[model samples]
Target chain A: MTIREIGDLLDARVLCGKDLDVDVKSACGSDMMSDVLAFVKHRAALLTGLVNPQVIRTAEMMDMLCVVFVRDKTPTIDMIELAEESGIAVLATSKRMYEACGILYANGLKGNGELHG
Target chain B: MGESLAFHYEVDGGDFTSAGQASVKIKKNLRQLGVDAETIRRVSIAMYEGEINMVIHANGGNADVIVDDTGVTIILADKGPGIADTEKAMEEGYSTAPDNVRSLGFGAGMGLPNMKRYTDDMKIESVLGEGTTITMKVNF
Candidate 1:
């Protein structure tokens, strides 16, 4: 699905890189960047509640197309700027973590396949 | 691009927020060099994990990236409390990082393992109370 669809499905607000709405696909939700990195598949978007700059760095390193912040958590200017620089889209949603993940999952975005080794 | 390109960075352990800057730059540089996306991702992820380890474990360190027609090589050297057991440290779930580091979403004992996972080849050398150096390669 496109990032735009993800936003509509999760009730997410686009924070940056709105131009990239068409390129992203799949989605992974996790606060742990390491876990996200551990399970690298074809997923192109990361949905996370974590707000640190490392989140952007992690997305950049993983070649993810975007990041979605759950529970209406706002990203700092630094985070938005980093996402802009890295060419990764950013979105924030008011839905709680579980519900947001559930909505996306129900809409055909798998966790890029199972969670562990 | 027949000639090898080398980039060096000094990892500042003083700031956690700045830990992955080197890897970010390297990723950008690799992209500019027209490297494939998969190779670039592998090289950056491995190097970023090593850079984070240097900041969290050793105070700070030095990283060097050498790119050529053959492969990309990342050399990370740090002068901090060295690993006591290289074998155990290589394990997927073993970590020496403090609790605070965990809050930052790392130190889950996956750093070294992830490094190994992303790189085509890796080697670790350490001296207790002295320092450690890791060499990893990702072929293009």
Candidate 2:
């Protein structure tokens, strides 16, 4: 699904890169940034409750399409600026991490099972 | 690339907000230099993990990136409390980060393992009380 479709599925608000359209097929939900970094999938977006700038950096490293901040956790201005600079979309939703991930997964996003190098 | 280029950054251990700044900048630099996307991503992720480790464990540190057409080299040096066991630290599920770091979504014990996984070569050198330095290389 595209980011727009994922947003609609989760009732998420685009915090930045509103018009940025990227096809996202795989999704991972984790508050652990290290674990997120462990799995780098193309055309992927992160579903996370963590709000720090590293979340954005982790996405950037994985060449991820966007970061969905669950539970309505807002990132700081610096993080927003960095996301804008990195050309990564940002979204926020009131749903918890589990619910947000479940909605997207139910809507056709998948979990990339390739964990080993 | 005409010649090998090096970029240096100071990691501020006290500032979690700025922890990954160097890796981000290096990613941008490598992109500008026309490094392959996969290679750039590998370099960025490895260095980013090292940068985060510097903040979470050591009280910040210095990062140096040397880039050329064939590969990128990362040297992370820190003057914080050194690792007591490099072997244990390299384990995939072993993390010594404090609870505070865990709240920020780290301390999964994957930092060192991920750094090694993403890079072509990685070396960790340390003195228990003085410091630790990690050297990683990612080939293009």
What does candidate 1's lDDT look like per residue over B1-140, in tens digits?
88999999999999998889999999889999999988998898899999999999999999999999899999999999999999999998898899988888898999999888888899999999999999999987
Please state the error at residue A75 of candidate 1 in Å.
1.6
Which candidate gets the maximum DockQ versus the true structure? 2
RMSD of each: 1.8, 1.5
lDDT of 1 at A66: 84
Clashing pairs in 2: none
Model 1 C-alpha RMSD to native: 1.8
Kindly list the per-residue Cα lDDT of model 1 for residues A1-117, writing each as its tens digit.
888888888877888985744755567788878888876767478888888999999998987888999988899999999999988899999998899888888877877534322
Provide the TM-score of chain B versus the true chain B for each model in turn: 0.98, 0.97
Q: Write model 2 residue lDDT over A77-101, tens digit each, in one string.
A: 8888888988889988899988888
Clashes of each: 0, 0
Model 2, CA-based lDDT: 0.88
